[model samples]
Target: MKEKFLCWQTSGWGLSLLLVLPIVAIFYTAAGESDEVFSHLMGTVMATYTSNTFWLVVTTLVLALLFGLPAAWVMAMCRLPGEKVLQWALVLPLAMPGYIIGYIYTDWFDYAGPIQIFLRDFFGWHSVHDYWFPDIRSLGGASMVLALVLYPYIYLLARAAFLEQSTSLLQSARLLRCTPWESFRRVSLPLARPSIAVGLSLVAMETLGDFGTVSYFAVNTLTTAVYDTWLGYSNLNAAAKISAIMLVAIFLLISAERFSRRKQKLFQQELAHGDDVRYTLSGARKWLALIWCWGLVACAFLFPLMQLGYYAWHYFAESWTPEFRAYSFNSLQVSLTAAVLAVVLALIVNFYRRLDGRRMTLVPIRISSLGYAVPGTVLAIGVMIPLTQADHLLNDLAKSLELSPPGLVFSGTMVAIIFAFVVRFSAVAIGSIESSLAKVSPSLDMAAKTMGYASTRMLRRVHLPLIRRGCLIAGLLVFIESMKELNAALLLRPFNFETLATYVFNFASDEQLELAALPAILLVLVGLVPLVMVNRSLEKKH
Candidate 1:
């Protein structure tokens, strides 16, 4: 029994370390000296990069809160017309990537695009000098584009917090003759603060990590700096340093969020029962709430989807070519591979935790799960640094053996990208599997043990079957995320290799988004599967 326990513990630690290896590689590489490139960046572009990234995170957080808080409040606590449809519809935007939305909106709002053309013809304006317009490729525009998609994170978590709040607290406030708005402001908002902070932290990390959206808008954020430093100037050391800087920022945000959550727990109120009294809107208030909810859904999900469908319909033949097939195949191949690997890794760590139930065993799960908070750009930089060195070592070894040098085996192949994907998304799988495994009764484990089953056989016979649904959900979530991922994919894709994300990014970068509309739409459609599943799960829980 002791030997088996030792084996399981070692396996869990090994797997957890493997998942975190890329992140370790990044910081290790960054610790090395890079005086020349670092000095040049500091003197030239670092300030602008830091400033833009700061404003982007701040602006996106504010906008997402503005859009999400009221919407979440209305949907969770108020009875408005079409509330059911609006509730799920609001979540649809979470399925769309920020970069895809940025590209689509830029095309629509550009000076020569349909909106401007119609305005010009209608108002008899001839050219740019005849009217004033906001540039779609600016920092402010990028923030709004990201907010439109990312607000769903805030909505989901904030709404869940609202729903989980004690009804008696709100009723007591009402009994004190407080207005509905006042009750929410004084009661609901405080309780939901930690959840909102978590959502905002996620938005901030995602914005900081964003490459395609910021790149499309010509915003010189740190993520773009990392890419340009590595690929444009061929300076891996500089890129790693920039990535490390971003990682520090992300860690600070995560720590702040965790602290906020701890405070929330300290002050949290327990509900006596699962009962919530929802307010019903009437007169002008009703219509206002209806418009607010539906308008968000329209702007976030429906509008872009309609545009993609229109473009795909007209350009299907041109867009759906052999290259498109290759891109689709590559996306599925990588996404499925990453999904399976992540699920397996998650199962290993979680199973070990189940068997041990020790504080030390839980540490590996926490450390491994931290990859989700690390930006994809940082993860890619981390992955590439070590793999590149390993490839160089292998080539040198082959040369010493007097054999034809095997070139670029790890870094130049799909291995690095897939490894990055697994590291970045293993958290999603771990969360899902852990939650599911927690629901399994300990009695089942005891029963298996009484029947003389070993730990491995017990897991295979009991936990595996019980958590199959969770495993599927985990796989689907990781699969969808892998499909929409852009930063890591953009940075790590080999020469002439393109996933659907990179394909759409390339076309959108060249202002040829119409040519890539089919793939973009397909990506959105694929993303819907997990969103629907999540909605169903949430509904079941509610």
Candidate 2:
């Protein structure tokens, strides 16, 4: 009875409040506004935004699968040396913000950049029309930049699913003389389908939520359209309308993910076993495997870090200022707070769901995590609309109650910003914590209870002690995510607030890459620590 009550209070109300608040707020704001805004949006940017957003999503998804699957396959199936290191190294790119990659790639591939410049000098071509070259700021360039940074989500999840396959299953295939590639296609891909779906879902969400890269490349996706409506047209009503459209799109995606995973099951093994059965790769194939792994790391991690380093070296002597200190503090505070809070909320929700022993938890937990799916600008609008309404409602309540209203909860405060982070990132934390919880045998809980320990004690003394590393991983994932978060912070931050990401964004928006370089570098550096820790934790578990 007590356990059920706890579940109701935490997952029931707390999570329920979070789940419904922004949604309700959005509807209410739409209702309060006139229908004239919708007509205006439909006439202008709506069709263009919808088309661009759809194409970008499709392009990014296709590229991510193409680039991510082979690498995941190579690292997981082959017995190549450094394969262990490659598994962890694949996650390094998660530390780099998508926009930062945009900034670097734009410069690196521009006509005046080294690549095109070298081509020109080599061929003795002088004028712009002398040679044909693709523009890095095009829709195609946006897709490539996004795929490079985002494929890690696919790689990590797919690799885990690949590794988790039973050796017995593969051995049976080998008895029939099936090639490893054939076996992977027949056995591995089907079994690994769930993880691939999950990874693809994440990629889709990140692609949608992206603002910096799309906006930097002048790709008029839905996110950038929202900005134009709000800032350029000075029409908040039209912005809210478009944002609501985006919210519905995200909700549909959440529904689709739910439908896909509904019938899927995770096969639980009865015992622990080490993966000592290894196959050898030789000669040309061996070199190919090593090259594949190194090449991915180069594209994902080394390239971006080197670019940031070069920019920092060229610009640091001029860009450093006392303003950097204030921005640094803001970034650290927001990232740490958001990461901690999101992880804590996720722990409570996961525990309640576990105690109840219902697969239904998957629904709320997944939906709560859908903040990742909604564009950050759209999410900010969703969050801000509700917060502003809540503030207005509180002001009315204050007059009626003759007391102060709880205006500080969200309006132009850290509370609103942090709440945005929780909604956006709780999914990542839940993924980590749920994975840790899955590893802990249920018999341990039963054994602890039989020893006269209650549920609280079991969690504190047993589960927490065992899953400390997972909690660290979950927290660190949240931290890195928050460090690069831009759209939400840009829209929801209080007047005069500046985090490292937002500070860099302001400079980058002015086409001042030299000025943005320091904060961007710092953002990547801070993000790397948590990312490295996540990779290390996963490796230790393996």
Candidate 3:
């Protein structure tokens, strides 16, 4: 038993170390350089990148909350026709890659596209200067595009929080003559704080990590700077320096959020028997609700998909290639592998947390969760710098042993792509697993142990059965997340290796919207299944 305990503890620490080492490697690489890189960055692009990234984060956060929180409230508090379908449909956008959406919107809203063309012809406007239309490739456009795809994270969590509120607290507020709005604001919102934080953190992290959409729009954020420094100028040190700055900003934001939430107590008990208190909408209000739901669906799902499908039909028959098929296969293999690995690791991590009952594991768990906080390019750079060094050492050992050097295992290969995906998407699995594990009782483990069963046997026999549903949900979410991952895959894919995301991103960078359509549509289609499943879980839980 002592031996088993040590093994579990060490395994937990080792995995945690694996998670942090790459990030540490990134910091070390940046810090090892002299003050010259910092001064250069400061003189030219540093301030601009910092301002743009900060504003983008703030704008995306606010917009997502505006769009997401009310939608969550409506879904949780009201009964309407096809409400469940609408709820799920709202989340379907979660699967749409920001790059794809950015591409679709850029075309639709561009001067030559249908919307602007129609307006131009109708109004007799000839030049972009004649109309006061906003550019879809600006920072504002990136924020809106990001929020449209990411609001679902907020919606899902807020809905969960709204549904899980204690009926007694709500009742007490009602007894004190509080309105539903007041009760929600004063009582339920406070209880829902943790879920809200989780949701907002996801949105901000994703915004920071974004590469495709921002790059397409020519937004000069750190993600773009990372690419520019590495690929354009051939300066890995400068790229590493930019990534380090982004990481610092991410750490600061995370710390501030943590400090803000530190004073709030998150514990709350659900009523043993309580159903959602549904409000009936009146005639005009009913139509308003319908319009609002459909409007969000149009912007979030319908417009971009229709645009992509239209282009696909217009171009695919003429331009389909064998390369597309191969890239699709590559995407499937990598995404599915990463998804499975993330879910499995999540299961182990959760189990370890339960077994050890120590606060030490929490540090690594939080660090692992921080992957979602950093940009994909930044994280990819972090992963790449250290992995390359490790790869070199391994190759040296292999040469000494007279074995073949492992040239592509850690860098420029499927393994690295999958590792980055696991780092980026595991947070999704962790959330699902924690929720699933919460439904399981500890008494079963104790009872099994008391019956002379080993701890492993107790876990296998007792905990696994209860947590299976969570695992399924977690795996599905990770699969969906991997399907949509873009920046990490783009930067880290091996030579001659391509994924669907890389295929679309290549064309998007060149402004070849027509060529990018088919793969983007397919990516969105693949993402819909998990999105629907997550929505179903939310509704059923409510």
Name the candidate that leads on lDDT. Answer: 1
State each model's CA lDDT, in order.
Answer: 0.89, 0.79, 0.81
Model 3 regions more than 4 Å off: 35-38, 165-194, 266-277, 351-369, 398-409, 430-470
Q: 84-192, model 2: which lDDT tens digit per residue?
A: 6777787888788888888888878987789998999999999888989999998999999899899988888888777778777777788988897888899779888
Judged by whole-model lDDT over C-alpha atoms, candidate 3 comes out at 0.81
Candidate 2 achieves a global lDDT of 0.79
Q: Which candidate wins on TM-score?
A: 1
lDDT (tens digit, per residue) of candidate 3 on 1-542 = 55666766676567667766667877888887556655787798778998998999999999999888888878877788898678778888887888888877887888788999999899999998897988787999999999998999998898888877777777788789998678778977778778888899879888987888888888888888897777777666677888888788778777877887887765666644445555677698778888887788889889888888888899986548899888988988998898898887777677777777768766656666657666779878878887787788989999999999878567867878898888877788887887788788888777887898876787788888888888887887787778778888878889999888888989877888788889888888888887767566655654
- In order of lDDT, best first, we have 1, 3, 2
The order by descending TM-score is: 1, 3, 2
Q: What residue pairs are clashing in model 2? A: none
Off by over 4 Å in 2: 1-15, 31-34, 257-279, 343-373, 394-409, 428-475
Superpose all Cα atoms of candidate 3 onto the true structure and report the RMSD in Å to 1 decimal: 3.4
For residue 266, model 1's alpha carbon misses the true position, in angstroms, by 5.9
